[model samples]
Target: MSVFMISQLLIVIAICFDLMSFQFKQKRMIVTCLSVSVLLTSIHFALLAQWTAAALMLLAAVRYIVTIFSYSKRLMFLFLAANLVLTVVTFGGLTSLFSFAGGSLQTIASFSKSDQRLRQIMMVGISFWLVNHVLAGSPMAVMMESLFIGSNLVGYYRFYGMKLSS
Candidate 1:
């Protein structure tokens, strides 16, 4: 198979990890699953030659992994700064903004104390990611982001019922 096909296949696997992440009530488990998804997604973007997305995903993977162990506002700030620098360095144009925005939100979400809050932030982040995926020409990543939003909503409802408090 071609590299593009392989990238799509990788995204499919990453999607499974992303979707499964939302189902967990614990933040650590959620971040762990998302870490795997982010790492795989980084590779997928790299294969597609989307350097901005790839670098953002790589940073996101590191952020997720770090947060899974220990996270603070300082750490979040550092990640956000790194993300901004990466986005500027990669600078793929308007499409880069979408991934940067999404990754920024997800970085904030990673530092959230509440699971519901994390999911809520992630929902918004995933929306931005959907646009980035479309612009970057990754149909599978777009589908993954869409499904991730749905899964997050369902997971939120499952855990918190109708009330949406932080």
Candidate 2:
């Protein structure tokens, strides 16, 4: 298969990981799945030669792994700072802003104590990623983010019933 096709396939696999993340009630399980998804997404972006997106994804993957162990405010700040540095280093076009915003929000969400709050924040972050995927010309990634939003909503409903408020 061509590189483009391989990248698309990788996105599909990443989508599965992301979708699985929201189904579980435990935060660790969710982060574990997200870590895999982010790592796979990083590889997908690398295959597409979207270096900025790939680098951000790598940072997000590391953040998710650390979050699984401890939701430290210090670590959150460190990751946010690292994200800024990566954005500056990658320094592509306007599209990089979306990745940075998404990554920052996700990093903050990782530190939240409540699952609902995490999901809510993640929805916003995923929306940013959706925009980035559109601007970056990755249709499958866009679809993945869209599905992730829906899945998050469903997961919320499954866990907390119909109430949207935390």
What lDDT score belongs to each candidate, Candidate 1 first? Answer: 0.92, 0.91
lDDT of 1 by residue, 40-96 (tens): 999999999999999999999989989977769999999999999999999989889
TM-score for every candidate vs. truth?
0.98, 0.97
Query: Would you list the clashing residue pairs of candidate 1?
Result: none
List candidate 2 segments past 4 Å from native.
none
Best candidate (score: lDDT)? 1
lDDT tens readout by residue for model 2, 41-142: 999999988878899999888888898788789989999999999999987887899989999999999888788889989998999999999998999999
lDDT score of model 2? 0.91
- RMSD to truth, every model: 0.8, 0.8
**What is the model-wide C-alpha lDDT for candidate 1?**
0.92
